[model samples]
Target: MARAFIGLGSNLAQPAAQIQAALHAMTQLADTQLIAQSSLYGSKPMGPQDQPDYVNAVVALQTSLTPHQLLDALQRIELEHGRVRKAERWGPRTLDLDILLFDDLQFSDERLTIPHYGMRQREFVIYPLLEIAPQLVLPDGTPLSDLQHTCDVNGLIRLSAQ
Candidate 1:
């Protein structure tokens, strides 16, 4: 099985519940086993300040599914949770799931990107990631520890685990 990390977030429709529900759904994915999961964190929206703050967390999974297969499953989870794709980038949504890493591999396609495009700089992603994988090394050889000092938590607050 390939080990992977997925970042989850929501800022609409009772976001904490949305995140909790997504976690449950992930555990049910065929050929997948939920591994470690971080406690939820609350943070400001990455795009327009007008949107509500988001609740975020990261989860580790061991799965037999290929990367695209995993992405397809994750997108299905988002849609099941009422996600909508909009032209507006980072607009508020009921759920957002991204493939942050997959067994130290690096590749990108129209449908997915490994290491996620912008994870290093996002406090919401960084802290929760750190909580679960303290010794993680990026596909580029950067230590996850090295990112902690540089990325400001920026009012990011840890919430209780569900």
Candidate 2:
């Protein structure tokens, strides 16, 4: 099985409940096991400030599914929770599931990117990620803890334990 990390976020329709429900849905994916999850963290919206703040967390999974398969399952969960795609980037949503890392794999395609495209730059992503995998290193071998210090985490706050 491949060990992977997924970032979860929601800023609409009871954000905490949405993230909790998504965690449950993740455990039900075919051939996937939810190994661990970080506590929830609240952060300001990355895009337009007009929207609500986001609740974010990271989950670790062990799955027999390939990267694309996992991505498809995540998107399905988002849809089940009433997510809708919009032209505005990082807009508020009912659910947002991103593939942060998939077994040290460095890959990019039109559909997905492992070690997610902007993971390193976002404190909302980095802090929760650190909670679950403190020793994690990027595909290029940079330690996650080090990266955590470099991220701008001014508005990030721990909300509750998962």
Candidate 3:
């Protein structure tokens, strides 16, 4: 099984409810085990900053799915939660699920990339990931703490978890 980490966030209507629903939906996937989850963190949107701040969390999973298959699953969950690609980059989203890491796999294609390219730079991603797995190492041997300290994002506030 590939040990994968997924980033989850929602900023539209019923933000917290939407995040909970997405986590519940993920637990129902076949051959996937929800191993650990970080507490929800509220943060300002990364870009196009005129919208709502997002509630973000990370889930660690043990899954039999390959990278692309996992991406497909995440996309399906987003669609089920009323996610639309019509908005501008970093616009308010009902549900935003991103695959942050897929074990040691390094993949690049027309559609997706593993070890999510932007994760290390976003405290919204690094902070919660540190809470769950602070010692996790990248393929290039970079410790998560090393990455977290270097990230410039601030204002991450942990919220109540269900």
Candidate 4:
């Protein structure tokens, strides 16, 4: 199995509820095991600050799925939750699942990028990530804790956990 980290977030229509629902759906994926999850963190929206605050968390999982397969699954979950990628980048959404890291794999394709291009630049992603895996490193060995310090997010706070 391949170990992976997924960043979860929601900012519309009961944000916390959507995150919990997505987690449940993830658990149901065949050949995928939800390993450890970080405590929830609330933070101001990263882009277009005019939107609602977001509830974010990180989940570590063991999955037999390939990178593309995992991406497909995440997109399905978003669709189930009524996610609409209309306008306003970083605008509010029902559910947003990002593949933060998939083992040490690295790739940049037209559709996706592993070790997510922005994982090292978001406090909302790094804070909860540090909670569950502080020593977690990218292929380049950058520590999660160190990355949290440089993100420019506002008002990041722990909310709850599973």
- What's model 4's overall lDDT? 0.90
| Local distance difference test, each candidate | 0.95, 0.94, 0.90, 0.90
- Give candidates' CA RMSD values in order: 0.9, 0.7, 1.2, 1.2
Where does candidate 3 stray beyond 4 Å? none
Relative to the true structure, candidate 4 reaches a TM of 0.95
* Candidate 2 residue 48 C-alpha distance from true site, Å: 0.8
lDDT of 2 by residue, 1-162 (tens): 999999999999999999999999998899999999999999999868999999999999999999999999999999999999998898999999999999989999899988799999999889998998999889999999999778989699999986
Candidate 2: residue 105 lDDT (0-100): 98
Rank the candidate models, highest TM-score first.
2, 1, 3, 4
Residues forming the 10-long window of minimal summed lDDT in candidate 2: 147-156
108 Cα displacement, candidate 4 (Å): 0.9
The pairs that clash in candidate 3 are none
Q: How many steric clashes between backbone atoms does each model show?
A: 0, 0, 0, 0
Candidate 4 regions with alpha-carbon error over 4 angstroms: none
Q: After superposition, how far is residue 93 of candidate 4 from its true place, in Å?
A: 0.3
How far off is model 4, as Cα RMSD?
1.2
Least accurate 10 contiguous residues by lDDT in model 1: 153-162
Q: Which ten contiguous residues of candidate 4 have the minimum total lDDT?
A: 145-154
